[model samples]
Target: MQAQTMQAQTMQHKRCMATVNKSRSMMRTYLSDEGVPLSYSRKRRIAMNLLKEYIREKYSSNEEIQEKLLETLSVYFNQVDNILQKTESPIEKTMAIELLNLIKSDSELGEIGFVDLEPQKTIKLNNRNKYYVADFLITWKPTVSVNGVERKLIVECDGHDFHEKTKEQVKKGKLRDRKLFLEGYTVFHFTGSEIYEDVSGCAIEVLEMIRSWHLSWVHG
Candidate 1:
């Protein structure tokens, strides 16, 4: 009986060790990806913390549980990668990372299901070969049907130097907004200063918009 109990304990230890190794491997792979900018180390740390918290909450010392958790971690990593790859500029990238973390961490904001987040989405202009690339195109889970289509949102981070310096750029931006509106997307534009100065406030405003949409869907 003593020998049998010792063997069981040894097996459990091995399973736990395997889980730790698998988690570490996943983290390393995720961090090493080129899509993740080196400047976004804080975001990386948050991702790691979230992963660890998830594992702690959901898994035990069981090997099977660890395997399942690892699968979930893969999904999480994919989601993060998708968001990170949406922007190349430092300010935009920072804002995206901050907004993503806010959404993931906040219970109220996290409830809004995001179906797809495409960075640099290309849309052809009406009956023309010309196309415009949106900075971020987010497809939310069907809250309300807008003309039989799920509602979508566009997030544009504008830099002062490029977007505000030229009247032509401003005119083009307005045209782009009109085009997106025609395509049934609600647009939100945040300047570099606004994003850098008050990220949390910006996130709150976004949450309010989502909440309003959700409420409309539920009521209507």
Candidate 2:
């Protein structure tokens, strides 16, 4: 079983490398012709141009349809997951359980927990055009960061199944966390003991950490 898991991970690595090569090739193609690497914003601007043209032509008669299409595109291009979409996850249950704990400890922390149904992470990896799921992905209101991008808090419950026990595992975990950090995500790892001892305290710690981080851009 361990062998199979290793094999699967190897295959995933190969596929990811292939994708990265393909992306780099495309970028080189544009750079060779246009003398500039096709940046993400430029690509999105071109896509928006094409999409707007298509919508204008396709829905020429219905201004309402055009308006809606533009609205959808605007939202999609600008943001990621909608936190208020009634998501259910471990954090939601924790919120319920910790609801009372925080109230007893601190009124501010009490409002966090499961009330904010932290959805799975939506990671944009350089090698893969996919989202890597985290246990919980929370966006605090007043979410924008110093770089004008939305900040996110990724809560990971580390267990034997998903955490580092070996040296290689530790390296892999750190690389993953570094990638997440590069993309404006703050990651917090909690052991079973921590969560078991004080569920509300853990939740409150995450809330406060993220809150302090958000405030730091302006205040700090």
TM-scores for candidates 1 onward, in order: 0.62, 0.45
Query: Which RMSD values do the candidates have, in order?
Result: 8.9, 21.9
Error of 1 at 154 (Å): 0.9
List, residue by residue over 41-109, the lDDT tens digit for candidate 2.
575566567667766776688687567657755664343224313224433333322422232234343
Give all candidates' CA lDDT scores.
0.65, 0.55
For 1-220, candidate 1 gives per-residue lDDT tens digits of 9999999989866655555445544554455344766645565776677677757765655557666656756665666677667676655655565555555545454455444557778877776688877777766665333555466778777877545568997898898788778878889998878876775577567767776776676678
| Residue 210's lDDT in candidate 2 | 54
Lowest-lDDT window of 10 residues in candidate 2? 25-34
Which segments of model 2 are wrong by more than 4 Å?
A: 1-116, 126-130, 143-149, 217-220
Worst 10 residues of 1 by lDDT: 24-33
Going through the candidates in the order shown, the clash numbers are: 0, 1
